[model samples]
Target: MNEIIPRYIYGFLNSGLLLIKYCRSCTVCSRLTRFPRYNDPKKLVETREGRCGEWANCFTLYCRAFGYESRLVAPYGVLTLILDFTDHVWTECYSQFLGRWMHLDPCEAIYDRPLLYEKGWNKKLNYAIAIAKDGVYDVTKRYTRKWHEVLSRRTMVTEPSLSSILTNITNETRRGFAPQLLSIIEARDIEENQQIERSLHSEDDESLSLPGRRSGNEQWRKSRSEIGSDNLSSSACPVRLCVDEHVTKIYNAFRPVLHQFIAEEVTKAEAVE
Candidate 1:
């Protein structure tokens, strides 16, 4: 007997087929109703939970069922434009072909049609960009840094990882050690004050020189500047959430079934080949 493929991969393929089958003729609400496992909005204000929950359920079930680990990630601030809420959810999957995690957002892709891409539309608020012409095929770029680096920048620390001995050595190594150390300490204090000043005046004052918030009409100027200054390669910065440990567990648990499905599909294709 031939070895069998997993069900999870078939589920993944089936999910796209299902979306195409059900969503082609149906309105968004109608398609949403079909997935009763996902919560739906009673009103516009009640949309966040429903929207987030729906994405989470589809991502988790479809991807996991296909043997891919998936998880819902919440970005830093208000991300979705559709609802007036401050958050959104997207899916992450580990791609063996890519040798790393990748992101997908079927919901955003489905919703961000050219006819639907409004200024305040929920899809427009998302940080992730879509690839499909119909905006149904989703792919996110990689752009995440280690947590320590983020903390280091926020705290004004020269090195993110400093052992006690390393700190002492650095203190003793410099010429005019005492004055240099004092100056470094003073500069940090001034920077902190400036950061606080910028935060306090950020809403009304445009002239504040802050680390991340720029003084201008451009909303993304600060983020752009940070990205440029970091000298990070494109792959280093994840545009979407990559697989972390927790998500990996979910994927691993589902992989056997998913792989079997993919294998079966591949075998069928090879038979035709």
Candidate 2:
């Protein structure tokens, strides 16, 4: 078992208090500007809202910043129950100890909800569960023509790049660390360290800028090359229109189970400590 997985889970679970405080107190907005069209990597970070509302992004970033392998999961839009909408994102961690994947609902934790199982889950949901249990779930019933379409939509869309993922992680970590570091410096009357901290933060801000970052561009180009020429035109793809439908199905199918798993894990961790 790789030592990092447990450490990430521990770090994530333990950082709940700090995460909440930062989310509440920070003035930064969380809206993504390059939404609706998930393909343009350039527009990804141009959000007016701070990072607080985007807890999944923050959590994924945190895990990656700590060197834990993580990925974002979303539902296919087809299975929403009445009055339920289905655009959501979550994080999954690759656990070496369990030799599988583990789902981490950072957004849910911030919002104070347990993970649950939704009916008619999509590939992401199934992937998340498989990680959680360290085994595959019965995805047979869930697979359908519509579900395949959902998978196709994801494949067609631009998947997040390693650089973007890392940048997000870096932003979240700096955000998480800044206030605490400031508080510590304030406590110790460490005047000299303040200057050093400012310089470090300035560097971080420049590095995180998406425009000049070669790594982000490289990743975007790499993804484009992998997708080949088929279905490059978003307008030609019916999968985009059907995405919401598939997402609804996934949410309805697995919400309950996910909620329970999160609750139990939190409880066990608390008891152990």
Q: State each model's C-alpha RMSD to the native.
A: 20.6, 21.8
Per-candidate clashes, comma-separated: 26, 44
The segments of candidate 2 whose C-alpha lies over 4 angstroms from its true place after superposition are 1-53, 78-85, 110-115, 119-273
lDDT of each: 0.35, 0.34
Worst 10 residues of 1 by lDDT: 1-10
lDDT of 2 by residue, 2-94 (tens): 011111111233223111111122125432222121211112233312221244554554455445666555443322211222234556675
lDDT of 1 at 79: 28
Q: What are the per-residue Cα lDDT tens digits for candidate 1 across 225-258?
A: 3212222234663322343344447646755654
Task: State the displacement of the C-alpha of residue 146, model 2, in Å, after optimal TM-score superposition.
Answer: 16
